[model samples]
Target: MLLFNTAAADVFYKQPKTCPHCQSEHYSLTNHSKILRFTILPVIPLSISYQRQCDDCGYMTPVSWYALPTLEMLSIIKYFAGVLLLGYFLIQTVLGVHQQTTNEVSYINKPKLFDTYFVHADKFTDTPKRINNLKVAQLVEFDNDNMTFRVGNYTYKYNKDIEIAMRTSMLVQDNYFSSKTMTFRKEQIQQFYEDNSIYKIMRPELYSLFGGFVMHPPKPKPLYTGVKLDKHNQEGITYFKDGLYTEALNSFTLSAEGGYSWGQLNLGQMYRDGQGTQKSLEKAAYWLNKATQQGNLKAKIELAELCLSYDCSNLNTD
Candidate 1:
């Protein structure tokens, strides 16, 4: 659109200069006549019986369409055609139009979803490490298979799988998490887990300010709150992924009733797919509607497509 408008402006600028005072063909129209060509495509193909002319002297003007139709007695049909073409493309955009169609829909997004993070690398997205009074938490090297890194004092132990999950997993991407440097200091990681590090680290404010660096008291699993826990939810996710339909259904059903959005999404998919649950589009739509009401954007998009597909305009999603 911008390019087209620029081309239109170019057309206007290339117009021949004409005098309106005297009834004389004063200006050099030869350059304009020879160099610039004008094309007006109107819907109805308006015929221009009279060319551009000076208002005062009634002398024929050399310029094409610069001074507006009202100023130059522009042919209505020609203007109408141009407007129709623009309107054809822009009407839906301006009018907030929607297409009602019943069809399965798929969505694709650009590949560059999340910023990449390399281990041992520091500084991710502006949050700086202020290691003023760095408190070291002596962590125990309990998990032999676990990988450890200590940024300043915070020691994180994870399998390479966990690191990969944090770095690239779609599940983590949906929930807001720190994208900044999650680098670790290995020795510090060992100390923090042992509780010896907690004893030694006296200052809390220091840890608070230098976040992502030191360890803190571990909190209870969020499982009880009904939200699906991360891999941290050891026993819960086991049967859920074993393809055991009953167990998976039970887990998701419990988790969904517990107010887990992921549970809702999966259970909705289950209904949508007719796995252990009865095949129910209505239930799919219902749970999707429920998830979206909880601020799930994916659910909203799905519901939008579903609504548009089924032509369910009478269904009040709100």
Candidate 2:
């Protein structure tokens, strides 16, 4: 049977009383995206997600679940592969050969499908929504015009609810202590507490189910991180574009450290070519390797080429 948990229970709530962190009701929807399974045997969803931004206290919460309830996630495909491998091994044992009769048994491969792409509907137009098995209402937030979330490897969209929640959460988180409407609403908060399901996550091992819940700060998506990186990277690009090679080198260095591999590769190329800086094949190789680890394919090829043309005594291929 499929038995895996996203720890969503610890992340979201069933009947939330108040803002878990600030104990306020001011919240808005921020963004959302969905995970798709690319299997041809059946069209299924891997996960459904709702990214909620608290309206009252500027907190973000993630709500998600297995899209396919019936399929045992771990056993769905891998289990069958293991079975095939075992069958092949058994047949080989009887034949007294370590190899297969026709071809070696290998991992069953599947074709990539376009439907495997995550389908996203964000809060930019309306509050995109879906109720969980517990009937908990979830909202999808998205940017109205961009239509893409642009998070780390994943993207989320904007929605009205998400915007509202974000606005509310920002206000609450930043100015709750100074809000003119600081009067507490105990009754409404209590009911919300009853509905929230993620309350238990605060103390998974320490607290009992009946104990009170603890609140956590919202985690910003990589998109936000990417924005910071972009700002720095853009500064470097501006410098480089204007032929301010030295300034460009410094700016690009900061951007690369901030997780922009594109910046890293650019800096390496500069070192290799002696454009703005002195010719240093070693630096080029080091930075290129770093960029490649971040999935910069061009960096990989460039590094390889550097090894063949120059004496890479300082560079370690490993």
Candidate 3:
């Protein structure tokens, strides 16, 4: 159970409404809030839900749409909390954007040695055919008419991982840069800025942090639907491909809990391999059995192999 889930009684109604379970005329409305907190104090209201409890029978049911409270009728705590929480972040974001814009404008106009230019991967002549979206080009030489850059051999897909794009530690000796160099004409550089292809320009000092404002967005809560489960399974596969075993395990667990057969199979395999969590043959058998029950042929084969190594006679594979 979460630590800060709290429900508060809001209003009491003695109207001519009857409870479905028991014919009670008295009911109390309550608000259940999922809160975001700073230490012990509630900072923001993440979500709110309403329920109606019968006074006599103590039967609780979700409040009906027609009987729900209006926006004005709701508590002011949410609005007040939102203002306090968002105000600081808003100010920081604005300041950060201002600083970033000033740096970009300054760096672009005056070329300097080893100044980094964030550009589309396609701008590099020898970028891998895998369609890596973002690439860094460090300024090496420039004159009045043309500018040459030592393009990093690595290319990356543009995601939340902004810092990794400019990390010098990623550069290795031989494969760091190609023997050939890419040069852009002065007019082409101007065209790239006009077309928004040259996204960011910064010095080595700015590489430590990528975004203007420092913030870590929360991972979304998993939904228990077929589509959502499939997405989780796919995400798990991607994580596993990237050797992020812990993250892969988490995604697989969410998908498996939603009764996705592929997720169950993958989770069972991970258990067998001890990829993220400790190996447990019992847990492996349990998940593989679940997937097998759903007619997953791969899981059946894996379970057969697992049984050969472990004593499956007493284990509850079902």
Q: Each model's TM-score, in the order given?
A: 0.27, 0.30, 0.40
Candidate 3 backbone collisions, by pair: none
Estimate the TM-score for candidate 1.
Answer: 0.27
Question: Per-prediction count of colliding residue pairs?
Answer: 22, 53, 0
Model 2 lDDT-worst window of ten:
107-116
Residues 234-300, candidate 1, lDDT per residue (tens digit)? 2336665676776777777776777766667667777777877788877777777777878878877
Badly placed stretches (over 4 Å) of model 2 are 1-228, 257-259
Ranking by lDDT: 3, 2, 1
Cα RMSD (Å) per model?
A: 26.6, 34.5, 29.5
Question: What lDDT tens digits, residue by residue, belong to model 2 across residues 220-303?
Answer: 565554423477778989998898989998988887777788888988898999877899987888888888887779889988
Q: Write the per-residue lDDT of candidate 3 for residues 114-144, one digit (tens) a residue.
A: 7777777764453444656777677788987
Please, what's the RMSD in Å of model 1?
A: 26.6
Q: lDDT of candidate 2? A: 0.46
Which residue runs does candidate 3 get wrong by more than 4 Å? Answer: 1-40, 43-79, 123-129, 158-162, 165-168, 206-318
lDDT value, residue 218 of candidate 1: 56
